[model samples]
Target: MAVKDAAKDEDDDNEVSAEPTPPLPTPATPPPSPTQEHIPSSPQAQTAQP
Candidate 1:
């Protein structure tokens, strides 16, 4: 049972690390950069708006 559970856990990890999770985590980390970049650009737009 323990061995099966460990194998199952490894399979889960492999599924994540093998495919979908890589891009998910990459995008998750990067998403903030765009928001941060947008914030700086916003001041310029605010002045233009005024």
Candidate 2:
């Protein structure tokens, strides 16, 4: 009976001494780019001919 109790105590100590598992790191994501066309000519830039 004493030996059984000693083994149980040793098992409990081992369980307490075991290290915890670490969490996994999250993955990184890339940013989106803008896509727009620019018009260089304005209404004043146009000329009328007779």
Best by TM-score: 1
Which consecutive 10 residues in model 2 have the weakest lDDT in total?
29-38
Candidate 1: residue 31 lDDT (0-100): 84
Measured on C-alpha atoms, candidate 1 has an lDDT of 0.91
- Candidate 2: count of backbone clashes, pairs at least 3 residues apart or interchain: 0
Q: Pick the candidate with the highest lDDT.
A: 1
lDDT string, candidate 1, 1-50, tens digits: 99999999999999878898677788789889898999989998999999
Off by over 4 Å in 2: 20-50
The TM-score that candidate 1 achieves is: 0.42
Give TM-scores for every candidate, taking all chains together and pairing residue i with residue i.
0.42, 0.37
Global CA lDDT of candidate 2, please? 0.45
